[model samples]
Target: MTKPTETGFSAPEFLTVDEAAALLRVNRKTLYELIRLTQLPGVLHIGRSIRIRRDALLAWRPGNGGPALGESR
Candidate 1:
């Protein structure tokens, strides 16, 4: 059986900077560095903060063909 979460606030698939860093197995600072260098994509700027789309991250994987969210490659 699975245990229920206590926080009650569910996390979104499209993660914020901190959350995306954790998912990508990189430090948040490193992610920022990547953004500065333009090594990565999906950088949506909604003010002073940067956000990476979950779909974009997943599509960047090898052989994915860079499709939109929920679209089969």
Candidate 2:
């Protein structure tokens, strides 16, 4: 698990749909498509937003995983 620095930013973190999409470098729709296909991992559906755990993303691929915004197969 990752812990936040003094600035406070780390794993188990929360990101907006747009932010997550950006992290994956894809558009929001594409991200949704990935979610629809169940290709992305560790995505949580909160009341109104789709969230991905930062640690999960990091572990999936160290130093930037490939297009992980979408759900995983």
Q: Name the best candidate (by TM-score).
A: 1
Minimal lDDT window, size 10, model 1: 62-71
Pairs that collide, model 2: 39-71, 39-72, 40-70, 40-71, 40-72
Q: Candidate 1: where is the Cα deviation over 4 Å?
A: 1-13, 62-73
Q: What is the Å distance of residue 13 in model 2 from its true position?
A: 0.6
lDDT of 1 by residue, 6-72 (tens): 5875545456889788888989887887677665678788898777877677676534444433344
Write model 2 residue lDDT over 1-73, tens digit each, in one string: 4577767766436666687788878798987876776666778988876888765654654335445554453
In terms of TM-score, how similar is model 2 to the real structure?
0.60
The segments of candidate 2 whose C-alpha lies over 4 angstroms from its true place after superposition are 5-12, 61-73
Top candidate on lDDT is: 1
